[model samples]
Target chain A: MAKKLLTTLTLMASMTAGAAFAGGHIEGAIKARQGQMQLYAHYLGILGGMARGNADYDAAAAQAAADNLLAVASLNAGSLWPQGSDMDSAEGTRAKAAIWENFPDVGAKSMALTSAAANMATAAGTDLDALRAAMGDLGGTCGACHKAYRGR
Target chain B: MAKKLLTTLTLMASMTAGAAFAGGHIEGAIKARQGQMQLYAHYLGILGGMARGNADYDAAAAQAAADNLLAVASLNAGSLWPQGSDMDSAEGTRAKAAIWENFPDVGAKSMALTSAAANMATAAGTDLDALRAAMGDLGGTCGACHKAYRGR
Candidate 1:
């Protein structure tokens, strides 16, 4: 009877440990993904302000916007995802297995978008017209990735 | 002598008119760029908040950011430039002539970034991770434009 009790306890402990590990992984992914999304929103806002003429054009504002955009451009998408992180049942999640299965393409498209954004910021103050044009391409790159990898 | 005086007055009038036109153009561009810059800053702040867990990861914030970005992406850089506007003379201007020369490419990039941002927002609630990943690409597109066009 003692031997059987000990076996049961060991099994329970292992199950708990496994669950904790999985929970930690999902939480971490959530945290990283949140960071990425925030940055994306931030840059877009800056670009919108510039287009609308609502903000006063000044060196300080221009420099700040450019810098922020560059920072956003630096984020790498692949680093944000972990294997088996789909948590298939999580609310606000439509991630499919394909993210990990065809990760390379997703990564490539992400890089492409970053490169385009960087170029736009660089030209923003110096060449408003060119910046406008570049902004479009940058948007396109983002679309390409979403069309393939994003579930919704 | 009367002919000469009339000529002088006419010249003065024309000069004043020219200055006024130029000033208006400069002011318009400045206003537009300022608005865009502020939008970018706003988004960055949001992103930062999301990353630090200061803001809830929800559809509302995500959608707002995405919508703002799309609005920014739609701005036409070429239309912002007025004839005779120059970097050396214009106040609140860092835009160089290169913008016009490279207008097509710049527009394309901006659109790419916008589309990606929109996609991310659309997917925010359904798949935060996927949305995050797409945001990464969107950021990259912003950078690409900055690298080539923006100048200190």
Candidate 2:
């Protein structure tokens, strides 16, 4: 009976350890994805500035910025930010519970920003003035997410 | 004598009008540039939010934000904000006499932000972690400008 009890205990321990590993993997992926997202926004500012200033007015730079945004657009955050995932994480990320709580809105907004950015790039080479106008809409998407999801 | 007097009067009147026009143009440009610069900062907050959120892990969004910053950088305020030009303006633009008084530093800082942003865009695609680190430096540029040139 003692041997059987010991065997049961060992199995329980292994299951617990496996669960922890799985949890860590998810968390790590979320952190890495979040980091990438933040960097993406930083570059967007550069694109907006260039378009508004007519700086360099080069197609290459415009295309490069657009390509980067398209990559971001493809990210599927629905599975990434699951419920209870916002609890004290390493990224010092204030991404609140509202992210999961209101997941649909968050996803929709992200998609909207992506669409706006894509449209902006399309206008970058041929019609800079239109691109400039679209930038405001892109900014609005950022603001909406911060208002609804990010914590102080 | 009458003809000479008329020529002298005409020249004096033209000189006075020229001075007034020059002053008006400088003042108007300063105000306009100041407004644009302030908007750039406001947009920075939006971009920062997206960056911090890693909104879409998007390289294009990041580049777009970085590129858009050139508007604030290329704004050559030297001519627009001549020394002592803020005597009567009331846009709350606390642009000190030192803006024109110390134009080179102002130009340098603006250029610095531009360069930093360009470097950031390049880094963003190849080395996102480095791009994340550089964001603080970019923000410093904005704060430095506000502290030195912008008014409350």
Candidate 3:
């Protein structure tokens, strides 16, 4: 019964993502949003690499990457996240249904990322110690959202 | 003789990249800067995808990607483009020696990117036509820089 209910909800949500754009194609939506997520990962990986000493830290480079994160975070994301495009409805997506169920919270999380990125950008160009401190806060913010709202 | 002189200059420039962070590893420097460029590509690709109609346009998404490009472009880049780490020195870099030979021109090109990105951020979310026009300018600015300073 639980599986059946989930299947029905998934179909309904998929419709929401597809129908949001009217003439918009669902596959394109999925690809665009997923691509955005991949961009996030590419930059975050650079920042993390510096903090971990896995890659050398260049203050300018660090600053740029941090600023990029903040810029991405500040975007209005609603259009990219149509109601049904969660992992359930989309292929290659890991977003959970909770993103729609508690969108306000998701928004709060996005804001948190922005705040964290701002902090990181300020410190990233100063010194490694400062960057390391800011990195911790930024990572925590991202992890919190993923833990609460994203799917496995 | 020109080829040999060029090889000598390449080695000398590579040393500059290696020496920038006294204790830093050269391979790490290469990775870090290359990674930064990749992030730039990632964000720019999104903006371009919208402009090209290869992907669905979501105003919010376009704006975010444009903003991301602007932020990345605004960073101090000297550290990333350490004197020696051009295509000649770094294993995976495509940077041209001309970047070091005529750094002022490189700076000029960078400024062009900044200008174009600023315009893009302003128009990307509000008007597709405006975004399209700005996108052309932005792409042209990038091309100008690559043509002068990046290796084929």
lDDT of 3 by residue, A1-152 (tens): 23323433443354356432433344454555554455466457667778889777777667666766665555445445666567897777788888778655665666677778888878988988888898888888879988997788
lDDT tens digits by residue: candidate 1, A68-138: 56554553232235455554634445566575555445556656776777776776666445556667776
If both were scored by lDDT, which would come out higher, candidate 2 or candidate 3? 3
Candidate 1 total steric clashes: 87
Off by over 4 Å in 3: A1-106, A120-136, A142-152, B1-61
Error of 3 at A30 (Å): 11
Candidate 1 lDDT by residue in tens digits, B89-130 = 565566565654554565566566666666755665454565
What TM-score did chain B of candidate 3 earn? 0.80
TM per prediction: 0.41, 0.41, 0.56
Docking class of 3: incorrect
Cα lDDT tens digits, model 2, B1-152, are 23323433443243234432244344444454454454355334334545576343445434444544543344333323433455344344476655544545665666667666666656554545655776788788878877887655
Candidate 3: Cα lDDT at A132: 89
Q: State, as a TM-score between 0 and 1, how close model 1 is to the true structure.
A: 0.41
For candidate 3, give the lDDT of residue A98.
83
Instruction: State the lDDT at A39 in candidate 1.
Output: 45
When 1 and 3 are scored with TM-score, the better candidate is 3
